[model samples]
Target: MYTLILVLGICAAALFLAGFARGLRNAVIEYRRGKPEPTEVPDYNYVGMAAISVVISATVIALVGVAPMWIYAGPLMVLGTAAGIGVAFFVERPSA
Candidate 1:
């Protein structure tokens, strides 16, 4: 179970990185082409939540002592996945 979670997390992280890099490259290209700038900056509520989730998960692991990986891994993985989803929502949110 722990190994499965680890692999899933790694795969998700890699996919996120690849997508982020591609989006950033495209944004730069568009900016260089003189596209109009966004009218408003986005709020970072999701990002903040994601950060908080990670911090909470880390605190849990630290307190629990992960020498028992099976016991600790479930909650940590759930929190981590929630964080990732929060980030995805953050990126996809409309500027306001």
Candidate 2:
């Protein structure tokens, strides 16, 4: 069970990275095309991001030997992912 969790965590991380890369690529393409703004990511991107959050949360719980994994892990993952997404957007935004 633990091994399965770890494997899932790794896959989730990979998927997050891939989605991030894809979003970035599309943003760049739009910029190069002189579009006024980058396109919003689709629902699938959010799903991928959510998967990553859950995976990270699960990994943290497993590493710390915590019980009731959902209690702490879920909120932490949500907060962490939100902050991460904000940072990504801020960094990628056009400078005034």
Query: For model 1, what is the alpha-carbon lDDT of residue 40?
Result: 73
- Model 1: residue 87 alpha-carbon error in angstroms: 6.5
Q: Which residue pairs collide in model 1, if any? A: none
lDDT per residue (tens digit) for residues 30-89 in model 2: 778775654676455577889997887678867666566555555455445645654565
Cα error of candidate 1 at position 47, Å = 14
- lDDT (tens digit, per residue) of candidate 1 on 13-66: 776676576667766677678857677766666988899988976776686665
Global local distance difference test of model 1: 0.65
Which portions of model 2 miss their true places by more than 4 Å? Answer: 38-96
